[model samples]
Every structure is written in structure tokens, then in C-alpha cells.
Target: MTTLTLNAALHLDDFSLEVDEQIPLQAITALFGASGAGKTTLLRIVSGLHREAKARIALNGEVWQDSDNGIFVPPHLRSAGYIFQDIRLFSHLTVAGNLEFGRRRAAAGDGPALEDVIRIFDLKSLLQRAPDSLSGGELQRVSIARALLRNPTLLLMDEPLSALDARRKSEILPYIEKLPERFGLPVLYVTHNVDEVARLASRIVLLSQGRVIAHGDATEVLARTDLKPLADHLDPGAVLEATVIEHRGGMATLGVGTQRLRVPGISVESGIDVRIRIQARDVALAIQQPQGLSIRNVLDARILKIEHYGEILAEVLLDVGGQQLRSSITREAAEELHLQQDIAVYALIKSVAIDVGLAG
Candidate 1:
């Protein structure tokens, strides 16, 4: 497997970034953290736009920067396609003209041809339009298409959706989700939104205060209670890999490991793979499986661990058919139910509480 290695130390007036990590080059690797966590700064270092003393950056054995050896490749020299928060298309030119500019700067490597780039990004209809006439989602799509036209070895995106509203963000996510498979390039995406990370990232390099606090599979990293304080502002949830079993009565049955979950509003056809996010706050635990309830989803689970956060809340980790599930409950409920590690329980979930998306 290919990997990107970064070892660097940078100090600013009030913030400093120190990271030493080897991230796998597959799908999307999210550099996730709150603002000022040096996510963009780290991305810049990798893009050869920012340099640190004695910093070392390499991708799949190709060294981009090694400060000690006086080896540093310029941003333009390195095959990195960068898409910033602002869609930096040339306002003076039509969308086709802007894309042609990217095609002109193409590297000698095996990059996508102009026609293939247009097809991949679904930009054929918008090619003749002006940048200002496009919507936020459309602009980003064109931006991504222009970036891919350069045929970079990897892609760097710094909060590409941060500026868009919820609707536009949703409008463009499906396209971004298909980048790695569609373009055959590794993407280092930086975002603070856990939802984006959960939806798009296969590997997560979680940063905090300019340091890497955790790095691994997206499901494992996001379910960790230890990272709660950093992500407390975001929703706490467990990401499960499930397969569509069948559709019946407007709901879809998804198989999570050996268990089954029935969710509503799943439009995908049966037999497709999907990722579902179950928020801890939406899960309720029962000592026994309850009957005659309106809830349609319940799974056999065993308590893996319990952690108390703040004063009134507790986060319980559970083993449900070999996959992890989390529940956030009041401390009073934990004491009342006598919940403890290794105890058998039932996990109740509402069909509407589940967030479903296509898995990469």
C-alpha cells in the first residue's frame, strides 16, 4: 500500500504544529480537527507551499521536502492538486477557459485527459457557463475538475465545503465521495466537521492543538470517547458498515454484521453497501428486549465499557454482533439499570435517528 509520510515541527506566534505520521494513500484521508489545529498549515507543508526547518515530507517513497538535505520541491513542481475553501476560478474566463488553463499546466505523468476530466466531474453542461453564474456546489465541482485536469499524484482540499450552506454541501458531497476511485489519486482532506469526516474519510488523522491525537480507521477513531473533549461540539456517534438486505414498506433492512437494522428513507437498491451513523444520544439501553414498541430497530449488545463525562452524562461502549455501538445516557439511568461492563443488554434506535450514506 502507498503512504504519505510527514515529520515536521512549526511554531507560530501563538500556535505550533508538530506532526509525525504515515497516512495510507487510499480513498480519502481526513485531517480532522477544530479551527487553528494546523490542519491547513499541515496541508500547506505537504503541498510545498510552507516549509519547516528540518521538516521531511514524502509520498510513496518520493521525497517532496527534506529541509536538512537542502532538498525542497516547489509547489508547482510537486504533483499536488490543491482546492482551497474559496473556489479560485478565474472570474474573467468561462468555465471552459478555466479548465483549459488547468489542462495547460498538466504534468507529464499519466493525468486524465480533458474529456475524461469533464466526464468524471459531470461538468459537460457547465463548461460553457461562467464561474459567477454557477451555484456553490457547481463551482466546487468545476474547481475539482480543474484540479484533476493537472493530473496530480494526490489532492489536497482545505475545507472545500466550509463556505457552503447545508444544502449545497449535501449537493456536492456525492461527487467528492467518488474522487479517489474515479480519479485514482489520494486525497488529503482537511475538515473540522465530523459528519464530513465520517461520510468521506476512510482513514482519519485527528489533530488537536497542532498534534496528532489519533489516527486510524474512521469508525474506530470517531467512536473513541477519549477524543470527546475535542469533538464535544460535534455529534458523538458510531459509524457502522452495513449491507442492504431488502426493502419493504418504504423502509430498508440493513445487515450490520449478524444483526439487522431497518431504516427509513434509504433509497439505495438492495445488496448495496452503506455506512450508517448512530448517534450516541439517540440510543437507549434496555436490560431486556422490549416488546410492542414503535421502535423498529433493536440489537443484542454487550457492554464493553462505560465512561462518565461532564456531570449528568455517561457514554457506554457496546459490542453488537462484533461491531461497536455507543450510547449516551444520563448518569442516573446508568445507576438505575446497574449497567456495567460485560453485561448483556438491548440497544434501541429510532429509524429516523440514523444517518445513512454510501460507503467508499
Candidate 2:
């Protein structure tokens, strides 16, 4: 069992972060929560910047903090790369010079090849240009490249893209996606944006008020009804992969489990398997086939389960061609409609509710 044992107790005068739990830190672990939820605080402790009262933090086998045993690895020697919200690039240095700083500071002969990282991040053009001369996206790329050059065992990113605009975020997303593929290392990404977590996180850690409320697969924890209070105030949805068939006019045809769903606002080419998220509230169930509706996407499904959700609401679970879907409805509606498990029904959904995020 690959687990990160984190049993820490700290006090920041009037505020304390007391957490005792083990997080599976093998892949990208997303620290998700609202503001003042201690996500950044935990990151600070993990990076060895914040000292704890009684710390017993260990990653794999290396001892990061074990105050009882008199072992506490300092931040400098931790070999953990940290990327703050601001890129924090030195205005005096050029892109090439900034990236080389990590290589120079890295333990003797421990960093990755300098040439490869430069090419991988497409920093050749900005090599001679100073930090002040580069755009936001270019500076972020330079930030990431510098971290990679350090060849750290784990990379820590604290809302790295939060400071960038939409265009700039979109510009740097591809580089972020390729980092895992290129390095094959663990990353600790802290963010409040669900869209970023949906796109990148393999295992998500739900943090609330200086503690880990829940930690598991990105999809499972995000889909949980109980996590609604902790997660961002947004409708729950399931992430699915679909192959784009063709593009016609403003809509794109995609294949999803024995049916073709025409999605709107998709700007991708054919043969690409795009990831989609369909909200539960948008999905409606019917006892019998009731045609003649404005809704376009309809699927045959079997009732899987039903659970109580928000006030005056019940979430209906349906199995659609091996894919699970949830529909939020009123308690009175459920009892009146006599919704039961294994019952065949038709699930109606609109194309606009199908969100095109999280590329599978």
C-alpha cells in the first residue's frame, strides 16, 4: 500500500490545523477546498516551511518530519519543487538563465538534461528574452521548466495558473498536461478550481478547515452527495469519453455508448476522443417513451439506485450502457412516480448541459 502518512498538529495563534490521515500520494493529489480551508497550509507544512507541534509526516519511506524521532528534513534539502501562484521569476534573468538556475542549484548531477527540458517547454524563442519581456503564459512555462530542471521527486504547485487570465490559462494547459507524461513523477497540485482538478487530478484530497475531509479517485469523491458542502457550489456531473465523429455547422457529432450525442460548442477535430461532463440536475427520467420534446439527447437506462440529497430533493441513479448517471428530483416526485431499481426508463438530457471539459 503506497500511502503518505500525515499526522500533524500545529497552531498559528488562534487558528490550528490538526489532521491525522494517510493520503495515497502516488499520482497527482489534488488539494481541493474553498478559501481558508487549509489547503495552502497543508502544502506549506509538507514543503517543510511550517513547523508542527507533533509531526509524523512520511512520503514513501523518506522521513519528512518525525519530531518524536528527532528527524525533520528542512525545505531546502527536501528535493520538492515548489511553484507559487505567481511564477516568481527573477526580472533580472532571461528565460534560459532562469531555467538554468534550478540546474545549477540541483544536487550534483541530479537534474534532467537541460537541452531536453528547454525544447519540451518550447522556451527556445524566449531564451534570450528577460522575464519582464515575456507574456504571462510564457513566464508560467518558464516557471514549470525551471522546476522540472531541479529534478525533484515531488512537484508542489499552489494554484500555479490562478493568476493567469483565461487566454493565458488555456495557453499553458497543454504544457501542464504533458508534464506528467514527460516526467512520470508525482505532483501535488493545490487549486480551488474544479475544472483544473477534473482535467489533471488522478487522486483528489478534499480538505476543509485544516483537515482532510475526504480523499479518493477524482471522479468518485467529486460525485459523492456528501462532498457537495465541501466542494465548490456546483452541480454534480460524471466525466465520460466520447469519440468525435464529424463536425457539421455549429454542433459536433460524438459517439457515446451505443448512441450518438450531438454536442454544441465543441471546437475539436474528428476522431479525437473528447471528455464530457453531464450534470445530474439536467437529466430527467420518464416511465414511458414520451417523444415530442425540445430536448435532443435521450437514452434508455435502468434505475440503479436512489439516495436522499439536498432539501426536498432525491438523486436518482441510472445505468446507461455501463455508464452511471444521476438525476436530482424532488422527494414527492420520487414517491409519486414510484421510481425503483432495475426499472427501465428513458433519460432525457439537453446538449447544452453536456460540458466539454476534462479531456479523457
Candidate 3:
């Protein structure tokens, strides 16, 4: 596995970022935290955009920054591609020109073919169109395509979708989703939005005050009781890959490992793989196997643990085929049901609760 080790200290006004973390080079490692939590600063440090009083940045085993050796690699030559929050496409350039600018700057033998990037980003119609003439989604697509043309070992994106409207964000999400599969390059994605983290990150680094508070799989990291404020609405009880069994009109039939689910309002081809999120709030407990309930999803789950965080809310940890899934309910509900570890129960969910993993 490619690994990144950073030991740095930076002073920003009254607060400081004294970070020391070893981040694995996975498909996408998200730097997630609340605002002023040093998410952006850490990205800057990695990109060599922000310097530190004492810095050591290395990938795999190569030294990028070391204080004692005075080894500091500048940002321009890091073999890294960066997508700024602004989608900084040059006004003078057309969509095609903006996409090819990176190739023009690369070593003669290493640059991607001009046509390859066009196909990757679906830039056919926009090739001759100017940047001002493109929609927000089109512009971001061009920006990401331009960065990929650099042949970067790693890609850095700083909330690239934050500037767009909901519709635009949806338009650009699939492109971002394809990055890990298409390029085989690790992406250091920075975002304060938790839903984005859930949909995109293969691995996650939870930062608080420039320190790595939590680092693990995306679902586990987001469910931490400590970070609940940021993950309130992103409470996907479980995430599982499913096969699209059939597609008729605007709906889809999905098979999640052992269970079958019917989802609404989606455009998916048959036999394709899709990711599903079972929201914690959407799951209801049953003493026996449910037969005639209006709910469609009923998994035979075992209670693993229980955690109460507030006067009204309590979270139950359930095990579904050795994979942990979360369920949220009132404290009174837990008591009324006499919930405890090792108790066998059924998890009920409706078809409407299922959502496509494309939200910003």
C-alpha cells in the first residue's frame, strides 16, 4: 500500500496545526472535520501550498519534506494534480484548451493524448465552447479533466463541489466517482461535507485541530459519537454493494448480497453494480419475523451494542452478516423493547428510504 507520513507544525494566528499522521494511499482518503478544524490546511501542507515551521512529508518512502535535511519539494513539481474550490478554468481558454493545458506543460514523453482526456470527461460538445459559456458542472468537469492530464501520482481536491448548486453537484459527482477506478491514483480529497465523504471516500482521516482524531473506513469514521454533529443527516445505517436485477422506466430492482430491494426514481442499467445506504433512522425493530408490514427490507440482525448520547436519542449497533450496521431510535424505545447485546431482532425498512449515492 502507498503510505503518506506527515509531521508538521504550523501557526495560523492564535490557533496551530501540530499534525502527525500516517495516511494510507487508498482510492480516496478524505480529510474531514468542521470548519476551522484544519482540513484545508492539511491539504495545503500536503500540496506544498502551505509551509510549516517544521515539516516532513513523504509518500511511500520518498522524502518530500524534511526539516533537518532542508529538503522541501515545491508545489509545482510534486507529480500531484490539484482541483481548487473555484474550478479555476482560464477565461481565455476553451473547454478543450483548458483540458489540454496540463498536457502542454508535462514532459514530452509523459503527457496523455489530447483525445483521451476529452473522452474521459465527455467533453465532445464543449470542446470548442469557451469557459464562460459552460455550466458550473461543465466547468468542473473540464477542471478535473485538466488535472488528470498532468499524469499525477496523486490528485488533491478541495471541496470541488461546494461552489455548485445541488443539480450541478449531482452532474459532477459521477465523474468524481469514476476517478479511483479509471486512474488508479490515490486522491487526497478535502471536504467538510459528511455526505460527500460517505459517497466518495474509500478511506477517511478525521482531523480536529490539525490532528488525526480518527482514521478508518468511511462508515466507521462517520459513526463516531464524537463527530455526530457533522454526520447527523448522513446516517446511512449500512452501505452495501448490490446488483441491479432489472430496470423498467425510472425504477430499479437491486439485490444486496442476500436481500432484494426495490428503489424508486433512478436511471440505472440492468446488471450494473450499485451502492446502497440503509439509514439508521429508517430501520425499525421487530420481535419476530415481519410478514405483512408495509416495510420491504427486513434483515435478521443481532444487537451488538447500545450507546445513548442524549436525553432522547440512542443508537443501536446491529450485526448483519458480520458487517456492522447502525440503528437510531428513542431511549424509551430501547427500554420498552428491553434491548441488549446478543438479542435476535428484525430490521424493517421501506423502499422510499433508499437513496442513490449521488448527493453532495
Candidate 4:
């Protein structure tokens, strides 16, 4: 498998970042962290834009930077397509003009046809419009199309959706999700939004205070509560990939591993795959499967571990049909139930607490 290898050290007056990692170039990999956590800086290093850092960066065996050998490849030569938070489309050019500029810069070989890009991004109607006349979501879609025109080997996105409001984000995410599989491209996406991470990223590199706290499969990394950076996030949760079994009576039954989950207000065709995000706080643990309850979803689970956060609360890790799930409860409740590792319990989740998105 192809991989991006990075061994970097960046030191500032108050903050220092040291990362040594080998990221697989299989699909979208998220660089997740809070502000001032060095996510953007690391992305710049990988793109060969931040040359001051002492680093050795390589992509799929090609060395982009080697500080010790005094070798450096400039950003343009790296062939990495970068997307910033702000839409940087030229106001003087029409959408088609902007796209043509990028297409003309393609290195060699046949690049993606303009018609194909326009169709993929649904941009046919907007081609004649100038950049200033487009909506935020439309502008972002155009920006992405322009990048694809370059026929880049890798894509780098620095919180591209941060500037968009909820509705605009929703409008543009589906388009972004299609890029990797549609073009066979590997993307290094940076974002702090866990929901975006759940839907878009297959792997995660969790950073905190300028260091990697955890890195692995998205499901495994998000299920962890031991990391303070992740735990502090508002919606710490477990991400599950499930296939739609059926939708009936205002509920959708999803097949996750061998277990089934019923979510409310979701209408999707049977056999479709979806990504589900269940917040840790929304999961309630019961000693046994309750007979009478308003909750519509329950799964047999085994306690993997329990982490106490001071004296107020505790986070419980669970194994549900071989997939990780997390529950956050009060410390007093945990002590009352005598919760511990290697114990069986029922995980109760309210149907309304789940967030569903298309599986990328």
C-alpha cells in the first residue's frame, strides 16, 4: 500500500510540535484537533509550504523533503492540490475561466475532462456565472473542481468547511465525499468537527497540544475516551458503519455487524450503507435488558473498560458485536452499578440521539 511518511519537528516560542507517523494513502485521513494544535502547520509541512521545519516528508516512496540531506521539493512540484477555508476564486473570472486556468496547468497525460467535473459537482448551470455571484457552497464546489483539474496525486484540505454554515456544509459535503472514490485520490483533510470526521474519514490522527494522542481507524479512535482532547469535545461519540435493512413506521433498521439498530425519522432505501454517530452522553447502560422502556434501541454489550474523570463523571467503553461503543455517565451511577471491565450490560440508545450520514 502507498503511504505518506512524515517526521517533523517545529518549535515556536510557546509551542512545539513533533510528529513521526506513516499515513496510508488509501482514502481520506482526517487531521483532527482543536485550535492551536498544529494541524494546519503539519499540513503545510506535508505540502512542502512550511520549509522552516526540520522534517523528512515522503509520499508513496517519493521524498519531498529531507532536512538532513538539505533536499527540498517546492510546493508546486509536490503536485498536492490544496483547499483553504476561505474560497479563493478570482472575482474577475467566470467559473469556467477559473476551471480552465487549473486545467491548463495539468502536468501531463490526459486530465479529467471539464464536462466530467461539471457533471460530478453539478456545476453545469453555474459555469457562466462569475465567482462573486455564487453562494458559499457553490464557490467551494467550484474550488474543489478547480483542484481536481490539476490532476493532483494527493489532496490537502485545511478545514474547507469551517467557513460554511450548517446548511452550506450539508450542501457541499456530499460532493466532497464523492472525490476519493470518484477519482481514486487520497486526501489529507483537517477538521475539528467529529460529525464530518465520522462521515468522511476512514482513518484519524488525533492531535492535542501539538502532538499525536491517538492515530488509527476512525471507529477505534473516536470510541476512545482516554484522550483529553477528544473527551473535551462537545460530542464525543462512537462512529458506526451500518447497512440499511429496511425502513418502516417512521424508523429505519440498520444492520451493524450482527446486531440491528433502529433509528427514527430516517428514510433511506434498503441495502444502502450509512454512517451513524452516537454521542457518548446519549448512551445509557443497564444491568440487564429492560422489559419496559420508551427507548427503541438496545444492544447486548460487554464492558471493555471504564475511565473516571475526576470525581464527577466516568466514561465506559463497550464492545457491541465486536465494534466499540462508548457511554458517559455519572461517577456515582457507575459506582452504584459496580461497573467494571469484563462485565455484560445492555446499551440503550434513544432513536432520536443518533445522527446519520452517507457512508463515504
What's the lDDT for all of these models? Answer: 0.85, 0.78, 0.78, 0.85
Q: Residue-wise lDDT of candidate 2 within 115-193, one digit each (tens)?
A: 8988888888889999998888888889999988988877888998999999899888777766766886678899888
Q: Write the per-residue lDDT of candidate 3 for residues 150-180, one digit (tens) a residue.
A: 7887889999999999889978888898887
In the order shown, what is each candidate's alpha-carbon RMSD?
15.4, 15.8, 16.1, 15.6
Best by lDDT: 4
Candidate 1 vs candidate 2: the lDDT winner is: 1
Q: What is the TM-score of each candidate against the true structure?
A: 0.68, 0.66, 0.66, 0.69
Once fitted onto the true fold, the runs of candidate 2 whose alpha carbons sit more than 4 angstroms away are 1-3, 52-54, 108-110, 235-360
Model 1 over residues 1-360: C-alpha lDDT tens digits?
A: 668989988988898888999888799999999888889999999998886545799989899998888999999998899998998999999999999988899989777888888887788999899998999888998999999988898999999999899889977888889889888888999999877886799999999898999999987787664564344435523767788899999878889898888887577778888767677877999998799998888999999999875369898999888888889899999999999999999999863333333344
Query: Across residues 151-244, which tens digit of lDDT does each residue of candidate 4 receive?
Result: 9888999999999998999888888887889988889999988778877999999988889989999878876645657755635237666888
Per-candidate count of clashing residue pairs (backbone under 3 Å): 0, 0, 0, 0
List ranges where model 1 is wrong by over 4 Å.
Answer: 52-54, 236-360
TM-score, predicted candidate 4 vs. hidden true structure: 0.69
Q: What residue pairs are clashing in model 4?
A: none
